[model samples]
Target chain A: MRVSLSEFRPPREGAAAPALRELRDEELIERVQQGQRRAFDEIVRRYKGRLNNFILRMVHDPLEAEELTQDTLIRVYVHADKYREIARFSTWVFTIATNLVRNRVRQRKRQPTWLSLNPAPEDDEVPLDPPDPRADPSRQVEREELGRLISHATSRIPEKYRVPFLLREVEQLSYEEIQRVTGLKLGTVRSRINRARARFRRHIKPLLRNEALLAELEQIEARLAAEEGSDSDD
Target chain B: MFCRRARSFISLALDGALPADRTITLTRHLEGCARCREYQTDLQLGRRLLATSAPALADGFEWRLQLRLNRTLQEAARAAASAWDAPPAGAGRWLRGAGLAAVGGLALAAAVGLFLLPGEWSVPAPREPGVPGALVERNAPQEPAPASAPQIAIVEAPATVTSTAGDPTRTSVSGQSRTTWFGREGTGRAVDLRLSGAPDPRGLLERQGWSGGSLEDLRSIATLRDQNRRLRDALAQAQREVILLRAQSDTARGGLAADAGGQREAPQTR
Candidate 1:
């Protein structure tokens, strides 16, 4: 009598982890639906970066993002029965993440109005210096700082446009996927993403000192417009 | 629409979200408006910067989430199991305990009634159907069951002891319940019960050093035969007198003293 209880438990992450990692995303979800906790474990491990990035940009705090990301996975576990297979699993899962991030934003908005009492987080911490004097790391350090600036700028985008924008730009979700995750109309997805880009450009334009990149962008757009001629989707 | 509406479309155009029909309108406006063209270049730069600089997640995120999930599920299962196993609080707990005990006691009693009753004692059995119920009841003794010791009858039969087998008490091979008896010496020639088919009694008297003899033989050997005979006859005579006196007393309840006086006078005259 081989009892099923022990086998049903998702295998611990030691010997069986590599095999679980090899399973496809939907296959993992199917396993999870059949009560395999390790499958969900793999799903959480796979999507942490993508979900954490969107959540961190939305909530503007790393700790809350981590917390919300955990909350999203838990909701996925609790509501595993309701997942429909016809839909893309990522769309359904990111929708859960998006909804949690939305709720967290609403909760933060409900806090006390004494903004001065809640002092803004300090941002004056210095970046760690390169250790070796001969390490020639100036370019890497500069690029890191630029990346930090870009993250800060993206975080500042308005709440309405922020989620759809991150879904489109950072997560690379299709427009329809952005609509599904954020539960917005197609037009809303388009307009919010556009607005998000315009605001992001306005914020980051003064930080960079690159004339050639801007000139190249203009040449490319002009050439594209010229090539299209009279052909139009309309 | 002039650069005002076209400005919004510059972003959509950069993202290729603009309808093909609206592209011409945005394009003509952008061709005339250098300011909008500059805005478009800035938008593209910002898009490139965001796409390139999207931050990586913190390390060990999945490991932490897995631990938390396992802990939560274990807690939920424990809570559910306890709720199922636990009886209600207060009076219901006491009531349930009492009810379970009562049910167990009843079941045990029922099992005893069903299987433990004596089968041979109840109702008339097939072997004793001719025996009257009253006679059966009258003969039934209110005494403890007798021990398994073999009873020796002190009768005057001639000694018929069987050959001394290895063990007379061994009844299994013989297929009979009786044990072998010992014969008295000098009581005439002994007849072996093996030929006579008389069963041995395996008497305790035989096991002791006492002679296996009838009461008459024992009395004669002790030289008290006449005395023993006389005592037995005297006891029987006394019992007969007692019975006659009881009959006379019943007839002459008030005439007992008068009859005694008349009998004395008659004896004097004679």
Candidate 2:
């Protein structure tokens, strides 16, 4: 028999089903453990995009990222009973995603490549979003180039350092949280992140010293300071 | 703070992980050192760029995931249902599962008995000299056997053979015939099997191997025995069902006949 997503919700709570979208990750997971299928759907909705983006950056292959993201969610669904409230839901989910990506990376290393009939573009060809019509064309171009450079630099970071680096910079996770997620000692997490930032700067060192960009940054800083001063006077 | 240590602290400060005093010192160092100020600005810019660099998610991602989850759930459900419907294993099946280890044990025992102590055992004497491959039982008259028959060298000690209700010919003692291929290494010599007073090794050595019979023969016998028991159970169930169906048919026919008789009498009385 075909199992629908709605099949798992307990009957008595169906009418009184609360707004799962409004609930926190931990609360939703608790509901999921109780077999509330909507809670699981909500969890999937919440993490699928973030997980996919994170995995894509790590693996540099969108198709593999999508597959890994699905696998991660499926793992969460199947092993929902194993989850405890000891850590944030995001940390646990990211840990699962990182492990899946690590395995994929290892397998890729072993086999490496095959003779393709056709030359394919790089796996991580950045899909640039449309530029704002009102924005300056030169500035938009600079932003796009900088974004591409940053993405390339981040991917260039050694996997050990890159993981904690991305967790800190992109996902904005704390060092302690990265430690928990990566199962690394706090010192290791801090050091890796430190090394990753230094490496990232070296990759874009030329851009950091570019006179035009530096001048623009100075202008923006001055503008921000002037706005703060005006606000203080008011 | 040294520039090297300041850079590390600057990275930590950006993440809000460095202590307040260290942050104060790093801020002061950045103010004094142009290189450190540039390093902090570059790091900030990199972090900002990385934040906005998230690639667009593939379309229909969630739809695809829903399909996978449904498939997974269905497979798990099917597995559980089949497990629930499966019949519990019976004694014959259990013996079949352990049939290999038992065969190995028997082979080891037979090898020990044949090589170690040949004189103490009573080797069955060939009573009929004319019969070539004829098997002669101890204390029983020998019957002539075909040349194609298996040759057995059996040493019997007081052993009890349990007879099954269905097949008397396949009793536990029939295990003797299966030992024929053990020693047929070109000399046409038969392997000598020693039977003790122990309870019959149930179908352990009863069946003949097809071609220089391997341990597979024992496993096949066990499997066949299990199939036989299952078939017998099915037959009994079919018989019980047939009886119940026949009784119901007879009752229905009796009611119809009574109704016909009453209608005929009503027409005559009218």
Candidate 3:
């Protein structure tokens, strides 16, 4: 039953067979559950990128996010039999990732350690990885500053708001899905996402003061108002 | 007062959760009110700015994660072997043979392998000259392998009528599908399911989280919650009924006492 990757072609529209990478998460996972080691590898290949980005945003530390993402996938492998048909595989994975993030955050707060045992003092804070040198230097600086401000604003937001906000905005999960992920009421999730977005706006607005942004806002406001008037009339 | 509360509703409005009337009111309010409009702009700016700055995974992210997972799994295997090799001083549980464990694991793996065998997905190929493409069950489809042909491993798994990639609703070309196929003349060949990269939506879902519990555990918790709610509701109704009956009994007792007093007064008068 262990088909060679050479023979592992699924039915696709144009190709003679679908590539291994084209397999759905559920399909890969199903095969994994059925003792296909390569299937699990496929899953790792698919989710690692998305999971890394999500964890990085939440933890704000690159190393920790990688560790947490790895741990999450490991859990998926060991507990493949625990997933049910009722929820999406992605939801389950995200939930695991989020819970791990929460624990890491809680642990960090409990024992505040800014520094770890390292031979060199200079290794205390790892800087952001280098930017593309060929790109304009000034633009890179501005983008970096903006990126840092975004990260800072996100970190400053309360967890109650931040969790739903990140899941909705970054992960692109629906409000109902956010409720499932966080075990929060629908209303509460919406409210928190709203507050988180608003707070983010407050933090970053000063950095991005442009007349063009204001002009766009005005246009959106007008369009919404016209639609609102029609809806109210009805 | 409307300004503060409307701000929260504005988020809902933006998300298209607000009702028609509320949407109209909020929009009209935005048109008249500059402060509220400013609040709306902030919301938009927040969303627009964040959307512009999505995160990218660090370089070598996948390679490192894979390396870590391999190391962890190897370590786990080592730990298991070590535990089996040396049990605690008093515990007799370690007496179980590692060979038996190995057999069990292999057997489980083989069963899983058998379940995934591509032969199970084969639609019955007609070997006879006049076999119709109509909905007729090829009850017995398995054929004895000739010396030259590769052994086609038939999956005894339930007949899953998987269709071609173009149409999901259409059943597999096994004509009338059967859970079990019998040995019949001429209907020996089958084209099994060609499961490519498409997701099997019918695939069972199982997830375990940091809570150290399965989705089943969460489902059971939800079921227990429903039962608790029903019991609480029943208790509340019973309590209400008890109060109503007690009041009625008290009223009857009062009437009886009044009647007794009237009779005593009549006797005194006599």
Better of 1 and 2 by lDDT: 2
Worst 10 residues of 3 chain A by lDDT: A8-17
Ranking by TM-score: 2, 3, 1
| TM-score for predicted model 1 compared with the true structure | 0.49
Give the candidate order by descending lDDT: 2, 3, 1
Give the best candidate by lDDT: 2
Off by over 4 Å in 3: A1-24, A35-46, A118-142, A210-234, B89-270
**In model 1, which residue pairs have backbone atoms overlapping below 3 Å?**
B179-B200
Report the TM-score of candidate 3, chain A only. Answer: 0.70
The residue-level lDDT of candidate 1 at A36 comes to 69
Which segments of model 2 are wrong by more than 4 Å?
A1-18, A114-148, A207-234, B77-270
Comparing 1 with 3 on DockQ, the higher-scoring candidate is 3
For residue A137, give model 3's deviation from the true position in Å. Answer: 8.0
Q: 1 or 3: which has the higher lDDT?
A: 3
Residue-wise C-alpha lDDT for candidate 1, range B156-226, written one tens digit per residue: 11222133243222111133211122222111111111111212222322333222212222222232323
| Share of native interface contacts recovered by each model | 0.35, 0.36, 0.29
Worst 10 residues of 3 chain B by lDDT: B196-205
